[model samples]
Target: MLQACLNGGRMRDFHPALPFTATEIASDAALAVAAGARELHIHPRGPDGAETLEPEHIAETLQAVRSAVPGIPVGLSTHWRIPPGGLSRQEPIRRWTTLPDYVSINLIEEDAEDMIALVLGKGIGVEAGLWSVSDAQRFVGLKDAAKCLRVLIEINEQDIDEGLRAAAGIQAVLRQAGSTLPILMHGDEASVWPIYSEAMARGFDSRIGLEDGNLLPSGRMAGDNAELIRAALALAPR
Candidate 1:
């Protein structure tokens, strides 16, 4: 599946086309889906244009995007930075009047176990974000690793050689752990297409968008998320 990560832990200064509001997200989602994105990853923002976990913001974002692009599964990045961790981070999920189809949580973060249990306990699917071999090992130790919706093998390494090496390291860990969970592998700015091609060649799910990069595979600045998705689909191995 090609998931479109619309906007990540970033603000408007990153990209003017970045979608923060529900309206913008929904519109971009429609175009991206038409361009071949099967799943949506977004960072719903507040009135002040900052990412917010407030139930109201989540509810509105989910409702608007889901309503606009009916049938597309929409998820959000549950970053600890939003509320700066502790009970504050977990409280909103507990108080959510509206829930997303799923959420991607950074497994490397503190309190991740508690957060995973909470989201799972709520019956919402969890996408574990594993950044390194150690993170993959940590996930393997979980008896419930198989229950996760998917494991995101996020290679943040920008250098192509190092990024692929990181991917290999984590894959080795997951193999040793006997994890059968689905894998969504991807990278950022400089390594996006290389990693996407790797994921495609290996038949694993991959994601792309402004959050990960604003440039197209040709090194051109993308006009919007749709352009990126189109480029990503075109880059797939035949």
Candidate 2:
């Protein structure tokens, strides 16, 4: 499956066309689906244009995007610092009035296991985000690890060789742990296309969008999320 990560915590400075408000995000959702994205992932932004977990902001964003792409699974990031306050990390999640189809939780974060159980109790699917081999090892020990919708192997290493090695190491850990959950791999900045290509070659699900990078595999700046999706699809093995 090819998921479209709409506008991760990116600001307008990162890409002028990056969506922020509910309306813009909804519009992008439509275009991205049309471009062949099977799933959607986003980071809802508040009025201040920062990633937020405020109930009102989450509701508004989810409503708009789901309306735009009915039946398509839409997920969002559940960063531990989204609300950034003295409140417990799970407080914002508890206060959420509207929830996404699933949420991506980084395994390296504090309270990761507790957060997974909380969201699972709420009937929300979990996308375990493993950024490194250690994170993957940590995930293998979680009580509800097998219940996750998928494992998102996110590579941040800048060098192509290092990034691929990082991905392989994580996969090795998961394999040894006997985890059969589906896997989705992606990368950030300079590692984006290379890791995405490798993910496709390995027949694993992958994603791309403004959140990952503005440039296509050809090194040209993408016009929008749709363009990025198209470029990614073109690389899939036929």
lDDT (CA) per prediction: 0.89, 0.92
Error of 2 at 210 (Å): 0.9
TM-score of each: 0.97, 0.97
Q: Per-residue CA lDDT of candidate 1, range 35-150, in tens?
A: 99999999988898888898999999999999889999999888878853555778888888788888998878877778889888888898999999888888888766788999
List the pairs of residues colliding in candidate 2: none
- Residue-level lDDT of model 2, residues 88-109, one tens digit each, is 7477789887989999999988
Model 2 scores a TM of 0.97
